[model samples]
Target chain A: MGQYKITLSGEAQTAIVRHGEQAFPFECCGFLYGHENDGRFVTEAMPVANNKKGDRRKQFEISPPDYMKAEKYALGNGLQLLGAYHSHPNHPAIASAHDLALAMPYFSYVIVSVKNGKAADIKSWRLKETIEKKFAEEKVAVKHMAMFSD
Target chain B: MAKIIIPTPLRKFTANTATFETSGSNIKEAIQELTGAYNGLTRHLLDNDFNIRSFIKIYLGEDDINSLQKEDTTIANDSVISIVPIIAGGC
Candidate 1:
């Protein structure tokens, strides 16, 4: 229902591919590392296991160690947290009900859905609020970003 | 032939495929067959006792597997079984 021009740099593409591979059958959650000045964002896949104690609903928790490392990497590169990424397993690359509820105000959400072992599809979304405001202000523009496979 | 829907995380264990035609006559047999095929997926779906882990839920044709027959639930040839991992996220 929301529209925006989402660009993915080569690095972001690879990061997604790697994350897709690592979190097979479950959701892979990680952060997008980028800075305003860099003109390009690089995705670093952080390994986070699902913390669903007893429920089979899709859940994700960035491991503390991985989180710290991502934070460190972002800080060292003067990049900001560009967005978050996760996988959809067999479902389509659409945001689930849980996804919309957990989304913050201004961040990109990348969903990678795998069908039959292959990365079937990928898509991006800005929070609804951001999408609405972009439409209102006519600034529906987003910078390019890439994912690293490693 | 039961339609087994694979979750995204477990795809790696399932040869990176999503849904597959499983040849198990029932739900338990089907899952067992799948686990037998993908050694790494057994741990994520079943615990040490080989029981369905509390963290995973199975749905058989829109019905919750727990209320029906749990893992022993039978699978119709046309049934669609989904294994979706309940995901909990931290800010």
Candidate 2:
């Protein structure tokens, strides 16, 4: 809503990388959940299935059931669903045209770049407009969250 | 009456209210009541033929409408309906 940036927990960062690497030769995707602190938001990774059905390397589809399950999980842990994450194998960490279409307002999108079964880079983005034509990059800060066992 | 939980994306049309109540015997009527009460929400909630937008997922408590009774899904006095947009997107 204002000048907000994304904060990824150390665990989340590790999970994103691990998930991307594990799904190598295919795309991996998941959700991010957290709360806002002084206009900045910190979130953790909730890796859902990449259930994209066809061409797993090029596309990923997280069904509504997966989303609901994630939401329930977040609620149980006292976190909110803040955004989503996906991996682009053999590609850069950039949101594609199709990604823009599937995006709704008010959620961050974290994209991971995986090369040769290893994670190369990770970036976060948000749709800048209601009828968006593109995604604007957001600052992603990795921080250690002192919390109970995950 | 049933409680319909509105997700973030559609809050603008409801004056940014996160949840509201609608009267109906089933999910379809409950949604219709929601649209009737929120004039600006119809476009986002329905298509040209007035069907629930396919991307919108309606859940009655823990059961999805599709696996339940679909539009005919029953609604009791305390049903908590969640209207969530599918967030899956990539290519």
TM-score of chain A of each: 0.69, 0.88
Worst 10 residues of 1 chain A by lDDT: A133-142
**Residue B75 shift from truth in candidate 2, angstroms:** 2.8
CA error at residue A126 for candidate 1, angstroms = 1.5
lDDT of 1 by residue, A24-88 (tens): 76667777765444343433434455544543225564433344445456557766655667777
TM-scores for every predicted model: 0.48, 0.83
Interface RMSD, model 2, angstroms: 1.9
For candidate 1, what is the DockQ?
Answer: 0.05
Model 2 fnat value: 0.54
At residue A12, candidate 1 shows an lDDT of 65
Residue B36 lDDT (model 1): 86
* Candidate 1, superposed: residue stretches over 4 Å from native: A1-3, A37-40, A43-47, A51-57, A63-69, A130-150, B1-91
Maximum-lDDT candidate: 2
For residue A107, model 2's alpha carbon misses the true position, in angstroms, by 1.3
Question: lDDT of model 1 at residue B14?
Answer: 78
Can you write out model 2's per-residue Cα lDDT over B1-91, one digit (the tens) per residue?
A: 6899887667767997878887799998999888988987886678799998877888898788999889999899889999877776564
